[model samples]
Target: METELNVYLSEVTDDGLELSGTLDDSIYGFEDEFLKPFAGLRYELGVLHVGSELLVRGKIEQDFEAACSRCGEDFDFTVKIPDFTASFAVDEKTEFVELTTELRECILLTLPTYPVCREDCPGIEKKEEKAPDSRWDALDDLKKG
Candidate 1:
């Protein structure tokens, strides 16, 4: 279903409005080199126009390309929010409600703080043990004697 980032208050009915669509990747306009949006956000929301307030509830899904924090390997990540919800205060003058920014933040806030490529990732390579110092060789010789 095609959907816009904003909801027109006039379209709302007593039975509420159901919105389902994929918000374009442009919605995430902020700059972050590390995290790249893989695809547009898919959402299914229910909008209710109550007294002095507009309530929005639905599910949101987004895909992202992220690097593993432990190994620095690139990976795909999917964030799903089944109970996504928000509310806004409105009045007679409120013509439309902006949904892009809030939805973007919601997905970002749900992202993993330290993402990993996999659970079994071993991380960076470990260095081998060093050979004994020559100074300690003399002590070993004395012990042998």
Candidate 2:
């Protein structure tokens, strides 16, 4: 679902525009199992018209939850994604697509490669060693013969 940026764009009296909106799970797809049980995303977009170019700036803040790589336990983490800015030539066809792609890319880039349950989680426990087979013992005796 596309969150409406029309309000901000419509109010562009000057060359620069400031846009802010609250984004819940409904629009951002946070209800998926991987993204649930975490905080919501809040974002702001700023657009400026410089000459024939449109400069876009965006910021996002949210929390994420994921299973730890080693312990298989769940963990909650927060990511304050850095603001992103890009320039694009204002055109009929490419403006919206470029902005949407840039937003998705920025969010994905901010995510951690691997999330841990805790800093000190001892990994999956090692299993106990098994005793040597009786067949092996018999084979040893035969070899000694």
Candidate 3:
């Protein structure tokens, strides 16, 4: 889902900009056999005029369901991501590109590589032990002799 940023950008002033929005599951694409749809997201974006540059700051909060990597239990997990970046739009012609890249990178970095259902989840059960090979026993006897 392409989130609308115009509202937030329009509010930008000498002081800063304040933006609020709801992010649905569509934007995140958080799909796993174990994870269910994430709840709606709440976020704020603030843009400030620094000494000679523009600074972007944002915070997002959302909840998602995750399954234990080892076990198969499911649990709810909350993610709150806070990020900031400085842009030199006055001096750099590619300030828009840099800002976009920074935001994307921050979002990716905030996500977890592995979301476990619980910290103490027990992994899958082990299979029953099998009997030792007869050949190994014979080899042992030969060595003893």
Cα miss at 4, model 3 (Å)? 3.4
- Give one digit per residue, the lDDT tens place, for model 3 in 1-145: 3343333333457767676676556554557777654766656767776555667677866676777677666778877786644464543332332344344345556657777766665566632356777879988999999
Between 1 and 3, whose TM-score is larger?
1
In Å, residue 101's CA in model 3 sits off its true spot by 7.5
State the TM-score for model 1: 0.80
Separately for all candidates shown, the number of backbone clashes (residues 3 or more apart, or on different chains) is: 0, 0, 0
Model 1 over residues 1-145: C-alpha lDDT tens digits?
2335899999999999999889877677754566788668999999999999999999999998888888787888899999999999999999999998889899999999888888888776632456768999899999999
Every candidate's lDDT: 0.87, 0.60, 0.60
Q: What lDDT score is found at residue 107 in candidate 3?
A: 55
lDDT of 3 at 138: 85
| Cα RMSD for predicted model 3 | 9.7
Candidates 1 and 3, the one with greater lDDT:
1
lDDT of 2 by residue, 83-124 (tens): 677777655343342354455456667776766676777767
Best by TM-score: 1
